[model samples]
Target chain A: MLETHDTKLTEDSVRQLVREEIQRAFKKDPAKKQACIISSKGTLDWAYPPLILATAAAATGMDVSVFFTFYGLNVIHKDFERKLKVSPVGNPGMPMPVPMPDIVSSLPGMTSMATTMMKSKFANKHVASIRELLDVARESEVKLIACQMTMDVFGYTQDDFIDGVEFGGAAAFLSEARKSHLTLFI
Target chain B: MPDIKEDVVLDARNLLCPMPVVKAGKQIRTLEDGQILKILATDRGSIADFPAWADDTGNELLEWHEEDGTFVFFVRKVEEED
Candidate 1:
C-alpha cells in the first residue's frame, strides 16, 4: 500500500538541493585540473591561443602541457622568430586599429604591416609576447611536448626545437589527456 | 626611485594585461631572495595587477608610482619558505 501525501517540492527547493548535492559530489571526487593543448598550425595568431591558455592554466595552478605537432613545432623551435610569419591573405578576423576593406586586407604586404601594427599594439597595450609566454610556461613548469611522429614527418631534428622540450606522440598525449579534466586542440 | 638589480629590469612599456603580469612572473623567479626588480610598464592595468600578483606569489611589493607616461613598480622577491 502506497500513501500519497499532499506534498510537493518547489522547483527552487529542488534546484537548491541538486546544487548542494553536486557541490558535495565534486568535493568528494575532486578532479585534477589538467589540460592538453595540441597546436597544429604555424601561424602567428594560431600560436597565441595555446601559449596564452597554457600559461593562464598554470596561473590557475593546473598541470598544463602543450603538444606541438606538424607546423606547430615552429612555435617552440629555435628559429621561431624567423619561421613564424603573419599572413593577412587568409586571416579575416585579424583586427585593425582602423577598419579596412577586405580588398585592403587581402592586398600583398598587408600581412607584414598588419603584423607589425599588431605587435606594436600588443606591446603598447601590455600584451605579453610569445617569447615571454614561453618563458612563463617554462618557469611555471608547464610540460612542453613535441610530437615525435610529426617531427619525423617534417624532418625536424632535436636541434630544431628550443631547449627543454620533450618528444612524444599521440599515445603519450592521450595518456596525459585521459587524466586531464580539460583538453584542447588548437 | 626603487631598488634596481644588475640584471632584473623589466621593460614592460607598451604591453598590456596578462603580458605585464606574465613577464613579471617570469622575471621575478629569476631573482634571488631580497633582490629587487623594477618594472617600467605603460599598461595601466599593472597598477592593480602587480599588487595582486605579488600577493598571490608571496613576493613583497616594495613601492610603486606613476610618472608622466610610465608606471613604475618595485617588488622584492620573498622566498617561498619550504
Candidate 2:
C-alpha cells in the first residue's frame, strides 16, 4: 500500500513537470515579435533592402511594417518599374565592363543602360525581382505604408499606389516603430 | 549520416537570401505538426539564416549539411499554442 502511494505521488509530480515544461516553451509570445522599417530611397538598388528585410521578417512570423517617404514613395508608386533607375554618374562604385568617367556616365541614356545592366545581372544571379519581392511582401501581409506628408509634398494621391498600401504620417510610423524591437531606416 | 525522410522537399537552389527562408516559411505553414521539410539552397547566407529562422518560428532545425556546393537543411514544424 505504501509503495502504491509513493508511485502515485511520483506520477503526479511527473505530470506537473511536463505541464510546467510546456508552459515554459510557450513563454515567448509570437505576436509580440515586431519589426518596423523606413524606406527613404527610390533607386533600383536601394529598393531591395527594405522589401527584402520586411519579407524576411514577416516570414519569420514577426509583424512587419515598412514606411515609404520622400523618393522612397516611388517604390509603392504604380510606375515603380519605370521610376526606379540606377544612376552610375555619381556612383563610382558601380562595376562596368569599361570604366567611364563621371562626364561620360552623365551622358544621355547612361542611366537607362546602367539600370538594364543591373536588372540583367540580378536576373543572372537569381535575385528576386522588385516586383516579385513586393508580391511576396504583400502576400506575407507585411504592411506597406506611404507617408501622407510626403505624398502631399510629392503631389501623389491615394490611387497612385498599388493595392493594400496604407497612408499615414510620421506619428503613425513612430507609433509602430516604438512597439517594434527591431527598427531600421534603409 | 543517417538519412532523414522528409514529408516535403523545397528546392530553393540558386536563390538568394530571404527567398530560401521566405519559401521555407511559406512551405512550413502548409505542414502539420511534427512534419519535416527538406530544403536545398545554394545561398551561402542560409548557413546562418536557417538556424535563426527556426528559432524565431519555434520550428526544429533537425540537421544541416553541405553536399557539394549545395546547403541542405531539414526542419520540423512546431505548432504554436495560443
Tens-digit lDDT track for model 2 on B24-75?
Answer: 9999999999999999999999999999999989899999999999999999
Which pairs of residues clash in candidate 2, taking residues 3 or more apart in a chain or in different chains?
A: none
Q: Please, what are the lDDT tens digits per residue for candidate 2 over residues A1-186?
A: 346546567777778777987867656643358999999999999999999999999999999999999999999999999999999987979998898999999999999999999999999999999999999999999999999998998899999998999999899999998887899999
What is the C-alpha local distance difference test score of each model? 0.79, 0.93
Query: Tens digit of lDDT per residue, candidate 1, span B33-55?
Result: 89888889887877887887787
Candidate 1: CAPRI quality band: incorrect
Q: Pick the candidate with the highest DockQ.
A: 2
True lDDT of residue B34, candidate 2: 98
Chain A TM-score for each candidate, in the given order? 0.80, 0.84
